[model samples]
Target: MSRITLENIHKTFGKVKALDGVSIDVKDKEFFVLFGPAGAGKTTILNCIAGIAMPEEGVVKFDGEIINLVETAKRNVAMVFENYALYPQMTVYDNMASPLRSDLYRQNEDVIKERVYAAAKMMKMENLLERLPSQLSNGQKQRVAMGRALVRTPNVFLMDEPLAHLDAKLRNAMRTELKEMQANFGTTSIYVTHDFMEAMSLGDRIAIVNQGKIVQIGTPDDIYYLACNEFVAQLMGDPEINILSGLLRKNGDNYSFLSNGSEFVLPADAALMNKLAAYDGKSVDIGIRPQHVMYSFSKDAGYRDYQVYSYESIGNKSVIEAYPAGHSGRGDTHTHVRMIAPNGLTIKIDQLIYIDFKLDHTMFFDGSSKEFIGCYNEAGIRALSAGKEEA
Candidate 1:
């Protein structure tokens, strides 16, 4: 096992900055995932560590030793690219054992055959070892590529979207297999992917990178529940987090929220009030995950009024679209709010609906800066009170 670290890394391609001062630490035997949209510099970071691409600035270190000067083969790192990059003319047996031929340790034919078969068994490709790459399925070829990487027993494994070509069912199956492989080997692994589900499921720690800079690094729970910024909050969730525009204003001894001529009183939290007070009469953005929005049949309940606009049933759950009452002029536009409910729930399109805006589940951000103001709940209230008392 090995620990890999990138320090103040910057890579430029002509006028385009591929990586801008990106830094991250992958602990020994840790499965770290680099996640973001395309062109976000994830591959650049992996390349730097693999000695495939050198950054104009910054250092790549392995176990406390700088290895930027080392060649790709000497770095003892294994990389699986998105394309798999297998030799079409080579048989699966030869493909899996190809790396062994160039490895520093000399192995006899029997040893190579043993290792190749073992890797093939792990990937469920043992039966197809003699098939040429062109004759295999996409999933089969990917497994062959993975077997090649596994046969080397390198210090670190860098996988860049290795499962991108598989079907949904096969992709899910591979996810489970990949996690098991990582656990059994206990090798330090850095995986890069644009898929949020894969990152959330596979990584011990995830780094959300953009424009070459790491925006946040944390466990899946932390990144999901306590995003460091608006971009992180917006990027990590499915159906996307809903961003509602509103205003913060002082109302007597408390704070009030105003949006599109609608207003609501905020809970008493000196700290929270103080935080909002800074943005008095100014626009702010509030984020609410679909799961946080609750629907009820009762009109007198503690919830605002809305009208269901549409319904989309996606297997296990239903996504209902709604618009706040009296703001129809906001015009079938930004008024659309999505709510996720169990499959059996009885809801109709264009029906009157009531939603409890579980304020405790909301996140506030400064509209101008797009930075997190506070995450809802008692801790946010406490932090707000602490900030107020300090003032």
Candidate 2:
């Protein structure tokens, strides 16, 4: 296992900067994921580590030893790219055996046969050994690429969306297999992907990158429950998070959030109250996940009437977006709120629904900077970020 570190790395391509002052420390045998949208420098970071793309500035180290000038072949890092870089002329077995047969990591036929069969079995591609790249599907080719990297006992594994081409069911299956393989091999790994579920499921820790800068580095729980900003929170969750512009107003001895002519009581968490004390009578953005917003056909106490803007199914569950009463939930409007609903729910656009936000789960951010301020469980999330486990 190896500990990889990048310090103040900066890379630019003539006019555009691909990475800007990025630094990360991946622990030994840890599965670290770099997650961001396309063109967000996720792949650039991987290339810097694999020696495929050298940063114009900063140091790259393995086990505390600087290796900025090391050649790719000498790094002993196995990389599986999303494009499935297999030799079209070679059969599946040959492609997987190519790494082991190379001069840097050459093995005899006896050992090669053992490793090839083991990798093929684990990837469930044993039946496709004799098939060439042209004879296999995209998903099959991706598996072969992953198997090729998996056969080697490299110092670290660098996987750049290895499962990107697979179908949904196959993608999920391969994700589980990859997780198990990482655990069994105990290899330090750096994975790059734009999929939130994949990053949360496979990574021991994840780094959120955006516009060439590292936004936040933390465990999945630290990220999901305590995102440092509105961008990170929206990127980490599906259906996106609801960011409502509002003012924290003092209500007698307590405080409440006022937004769009509606009011909701804030939780009595002492820490959260203390943080919001400064924001009282000023604008703030309260982030509430879809799961925290509830909707009912019938009016319930504390629920405000909203016009259903859209209701669409996303597999087993559906997302219902509602606009505050009288507003046209149309183009250029960003005031609608989204909530989760069961699939097959009988609903129609423009239907009136009553919804309420779960104030206890609300996350507050600065209105101007969009930076995180506090949340209901601020203490608990801070503990988790500090590497403490809850009892």
Candidate 3:
């Protein structure tokens, strides 16, 4: 396998900018992921790498040599699309064997059978080898599509939302199987998906794309706890992170944030206080995951009591939407604070409940620039740009 690199790539579709100066260095045999929302140019990147779509600017390289001019057939890369893209008239076995029978591979019948069956076995589709695509279930069809790619011994594997269309159960099963299969082959791969499940569970490192640009690249832990901006923080979680706006205050070395007239005294750290000093008396947004917020039936010593505005039952847990005790509301979407509680907990709308911030888990972002600035964690206060796990 070879290391893959894209340098400052640019591409356009008519008047639309599909990729704007995108660059990434995928290590040899690393399961790297391209993760972002729709229209983020994830597929365009895969096409460029496979020679299906060429960039108007920038270099594509295999190891240290440029492959910008290489033909698609010569690239030795296999791709599995979100659509199965299988032949309707061909049996499962025949479809799986098509690549081997192509001009470049040209494997004999016995070898084709050997490869196809092995792939079918890996996908647990050997029993359906004689059936056509229409005769099999949707999940079965998807497995065949994956089997087609698995039978090939390509230098790289490119997958674009391969499990996007499957039902939740099937998606979970396939996701687990795919991770195990990747481990077995140890093939260099670049997988693209909008789903965090795939990105977090599968990638050794994930590149989060947005509006045709690579915004941030890091391990799942880094991206979740040390997000670069408001966009990344909101995109990485389900039900979304709990975001609150407040006034920042600094009196000498003491620092605290005033949200809805109540003050939250943040632990002091010289370096972090220095960075936040600029925003004193100004409004900034703070974010913490719902799980990190704890609620008590009554007011605790240092915690504030809030009034529950709404609540929803979600499986074994409940999400409670609340506001500060005296708060009327703030205009725009940042009006309410959300908390998570156990399923059986007694709670209701308009009820007053006490809340506390696990400061060690809270994140602060600049209100205007929308970029992550610092956080209050177990290690006291630290800036996110420092990129070190709080000890």
Candidate 4:
């Protein structure tokens, strides 16, 4: 295993800038993922690393050695693309063995057979070895492509949406299998995907890229819990984090925020209030996840009362949609706030309901800048303003 590093990388296609001084470090044997929306330059980064495309500037290094001048084959890296990229005329076995047949890395016939069989077994393609690429299903053909990449035991692995073509069930199964394969081989791998779930599950560290720049890079928990900005906070979670506008103010000795006419005391630290002091009268966006909102009976003790507008039971859990009387105009007429409920909760649309928020899970941000102000804690909210104290 080896570390792959990109420093000040830049790439452009005619008028479009694909990569803009993008840089990331893939630790030895770590599963690093590049995640973003479409046209975010994910594939361009992979191509630069694979030597398929050269960057206009910056260095590509493998384990501390520069490799920009190296040929793609000499880079000793394997890439599994979205399309199966299998030859229609070749059988699964032939496809798997193609990488080993290269004269660049000569091995005896027995050695090649052993490697091919091992890769086939890992991908569960041993039974389909004799089937031609044309005769196999999409999932089976993709397994062959993965097998071909695995056969060589390269220093690094680059997988570009390898499971995109598979059905949901098969894709899930392959996700588990791919993680296991990476663990078993301990090869440094770079995975690129638009799916947030995949990035959260498969990556040891993820770089969330946007518009040819890395917005954030950290472990899944770090990125999810401590998002760098509003774009990232909204992009990383399921059902998406809810963003509501509010006005911050000081009332007596306490600090509170008002949304429409509804008001709540700030549960964050006084220092954080000071940090946000400048935006006192301005609109700020508050974010809360679906899971953090609790649903209860109208008379439940310690519950803040609310009214249910609509809801949908999605099997194991229910999505309780409600409307804040004060913020009614800001929300959609059809749906306002949504809370995930436990089973056996008897609830109906337009029902009188009550709910409470998990203060610890709340996040605040500057309305205009869209950057996180701080995270809420029992003592109050703690500011992450280490260097920007002036702000």
Q: Write the per-residue lDDT of candidate 4 for residues 177-268, one digit (tens) a residue.
A: 77777667678999999888889889888999999999898777767777888899988876678777788787765567787466777665
For each candidate, what is the lDDT? Answer: 0.83, 0.90, 0.85, 0.81
lDDT of 3: 0.85
**True-structure Cα RMSD, model 3:** 3.3
Model 1 CA lDDT for position 272: 65
| TM-score against native, each model | 0.88, 0.95, 0.90, 0.87
Sorted on TM-score, best first, the list reads 2, 3, 1, 4
Question: Candidate 2 regions off by >4 Å?
Answer: 382-391
lDDT of 1 by residue, 1-391 (tens): 7999999999999999999998899998888999999999999899999998999999999998999999998998988987889988889998888888875755788999999988888888889998999998888888888889888778899999999878888998888887777667668899999888899888888999998899998777667777777888888777678778888888999877787666767767665676777888888988889888888778865677888887777777888878887656246557667788778767776778887676667778888888888765647555554553243
What digit string (tens of lDDT, one per residue) describes model 2 on residues 164-255?
87878888888887777766767898999989999999988999999999999988888998999999999988899999998889987679
Residue-level error in angstroms, candidate 4, position 289: 1.2
Q: Which candidate tops lDDT? A: 2
Cα distance off (Å), candidate 4, residue 305: 5.7
